[model samples]
Target: MKKRVEHGLERFIFSSRWLMAPFYVGLIGALVLLLVKFVQELLHIAPNILSLKDSEVILAVLTLVDLSLAGNL
Candidate 1:
């Protein structure tokens, strides 16, 4: 009886790993979306860099940095 209980507990512990799979997939999806946004922001800023005022350019650069930090996390 003790051996049977031990075997069942081990099986449960092993199978529990599957429960975490969805979380991993979700995190990957979010990161991919973040990357897409980052590229979009870069493209948006590039062509306008020369026309933008100093303050506006600074703000745009800061926004890119923020997105980069978020992706790293």
Candidate 2:
């Protein structure tokens, strides 16, 4: 009886791994989307950099950094 319970518990724990598969896939997707946004933002800001104030450039970089950190989390 004890061995049977152990085997059942082991199986249950093993199967639980599948529950996190979707979460990992979602994170990957989020990272990809964030990357695309970062690139787009860079392209949009590149030509305007000379005219942009220091604060404007800082805000744009910070936005990109925030998105990347969120995707990592």
Candidate 3:
């Protein structure tokens, strides 16, 4: 009986891997987009950091962080 239960559990885990495959692929794509956006933000800031108001800079930074978190999820 114990052996049967173990065998069932093993099969269940193997099948579940297929369900998670898409999730892994989506996470990788999101991570790549996040990296691209991060670089874009840096470029935008480099020219205006001194001229832009502090609040504007803060807002852009917050947006970058939000994108990173969403990608991680």
Best by TM-score: 2
User: Among all windows of ten consecutive residues in candidate 3, which has the lowest summed lDDT?
Assistant: 64-73
The top-ranked prediction according to lDDT is 1
lDDT tens digits by residue: candidate 1, 1-73: 9999999999999999999999999989989998999999999999988999999999999998998898888
Whole-model Cα lDDT per candidate? 0.93, 0.91, 0.87
Q: Global CA lDDT of candidate 1, please? A: 0.93
Residue pairs clashing in model 1 are: none
Q: What is candidate 3's lDDT per residue for 1-73, written digit by digit as tens?
A: 9999999999999988899889988888878888898889889888988888999989988888887787767
User: How does model 3 score by TM-score?
Assistant: 0.72
Error of 3 at 3 (Å): 1.8
Error of model 1, residue 37, in angstroms? 0.9
Runs with alpha carbons beyond 4 Å of true place in candidate 1: 1-11
TM-score, candidate 2, is 0.81
| Model 1 RMSD, rounded to 1 decimal | 2.1
Q: Please tell me which model should have the higher TM-score, number 1 or number 2.
A: 2
